[model samples]
Target: MSLISTSSPSSKTLPILRGQHLHLWFDHEKTKALDDMNYAISENEFVAITGPSGCGKSSLLNLLGTLEIPTGGTLFFRNQNYHDIQDLALFRRQHIGFIFQSFHLIPTLSALDNILVPTLGNSQQKKDVTERALDLLNMLNLGGRSNHFPSQLSGGERQRVAIARALINQPDILLADEPTGSLDSINAQQVLDILCEIKQQQSLTIVMVTHDPAVALRADREVRMRDGKALDMTQVLT
Candidate 1:
């Protein structure tokens, strides 16, 4: 691991996402989820945010995903400031995809339907979205499980569906919070392999939050957090 400061400039390409002196507080400034955090993620880079519980890893991920706004400081997507984006939901739909540890699939919906959930109010035609969903399922090796419900599928299978769903929208950034946290080692490795392949094939930028150092090692860089701030950012030598 090559240690680097959070404020260091990237020599390769401009950051797809960047944060400076970010702060997120709750309950009238009582809970500071993010305190003076600074970070940057280059395009097509796979970066991991790792830390102990309540260290604000997920909170930072949420801010990057545009699911939550910061209380202070600045966040930028390329040259665009986050605060300048008026419609956060539309911005997310166009630029971000999310995966969670729990799968978060609807028990009543089939795998394919669940995958199509993100496309549900979009202007795209139903046929097009369905075709894309099927393609994603096939890519994740879950084509045969398209009709399987969350309850009917194994944990790994359900997670695969969630992965497919995240890619269905063709977002520029994939924000994953503990995507493999609930799986066994074998399944976790499988999921990481798929993500790697996806990144190569699609040139996707992945920002993942994980507690496992092994998983963090798989990323191009790791941003370790503590006390709601980035302690350091390190480039992983492959």
Candidate 2:
């Protein structure tokens, strides 16, 4: 199904992200990771992509994050076609952040260092980047654990560190794949609360993939996928 925009025509802003008839194939086109999927996300919206295993949840997230190129169809970022973007890597760094189920933190690096990893080799001054990283750590409530490595932190702390790293670049969009899948109930809820708070505070557009209905309900809207296609997209009733 095409996930058409429901916004009023009087609105001037365009969707921050949109996918039109997107397809991603594997195994010589035998495996359709995404088949004619259509989706859109507005600025500052929190969207959850929910489906069972192998239903292309992660694939869709990858496409949105520019980590994977679609084999067919087109994607747009605020009306700019993906194919027109000359530098995918730079585009991702400037506009997108990613969180994963595994936390994806560097075990050997301190929390502050991990948060600063994305700023490496960039034109941003070292002093400024360090200041931003420290600020993010403090914002995420890790003010006292800047020196702690991933190995030394608890599951929730590690996830918060990952979140800080993702936000270090000040991205406009956050693509999270099963962000709370690895945590227990309490930690999962805490992480979800953090995401919601960050979204409101930073005006970030979040696209999260998960199989948990409870988690999906936490989002502003839920897009249900099946057989690599979006079956339904509806706003969650508060």
Candidate 3:
């Protein structure tokens, strides 16, 4: 785990995340999953990474989300090299939140407990954090389903629980990997709408990887990838 401070990001800050000449390898076979990928994301900007399957979108997301360090080059957060940080888990817990297509919730835990999981063992007051968890569940339209287990909830409801869990620590950045891939069209659209709403209200930067063009189009900018390198980047609405 890497060391992290619980400081909030200011609006005037430039480039919340930057990666230059990044590379990643696996096994002794030297399979370069990420090859010289470079990109930057500004504060509160909604950016999407889109490409064919196995094009390294998830790999890039992992780097940006601080789940893994680059094999080469550097990754900077708020102009600071993240490599220098020693407690990566602390960094993730304090600054980065992740959402996956699978919704990764525990089947036995109630929706509220799942949301409150991340807030445990931290310095925040338990009662207050529990209240916030309930609020988040309600905000995501799961107010009446707090006691429901993941098995009992619908696909959309489970994903909403995952979102609430991710936001429990009030992270500065949200990293999502094919967040809508497993859902039907209607539920996917609903999830995207909720994401946009959260971004506007919280002013948090979001970097998402999506195979669906419609989902990618919702971002402020899209970076296209091929052969593990970014290319033909374009702005969507800015």
Please name the candidate that would achieve the greatest lDDT relative to the true structure. 1
Model 3: which ten-residue window has the lowest total lDDT?
229-238
True-vs-predicted CA distance for residue 74, candidate 2, Å:
0.2
**Per-candidate TM vs. native?**
0.92, 0.92, 0.92
lDDT of 1 by residue, 38-146 (tens): 8878889999988889999899989998888899999999878999999888888888999999999999999999999999869999999999999999988998999
User: What is the alpha-carbon lDDT of model 3 when measured against the actual structure?
Assistant: 0.87
Q: Candidate order by lDDT, highest to lowest?
A: 1, 2, 3
Indicate the residue-level lDDT of 126 in model 1: 99
Mind giving the per-residue lDDT tens digits that candidate 3 earns over 1-238? Answer: 7588678566466688888788987775367778888887888999988888888889888988777777898998886798888888888899988999999998889999999888776899999999899999889999999999999999988998999999999999999999999899999999999999999999889999999999988998888898788875343223
Clashing pairs in 2: none
- What local distance difference test score does each model get? 0.90, 0.89, 0.87
Write down the TM-score for model 2: 0.92
The per-residue C-alpha lDDT of model 3 at residue 149 equals: 95
Q: Residue 186 of candidate 2: its Cα lDDT?
A: 94
Worst 10 residues of 1 by lDDT: 229-238
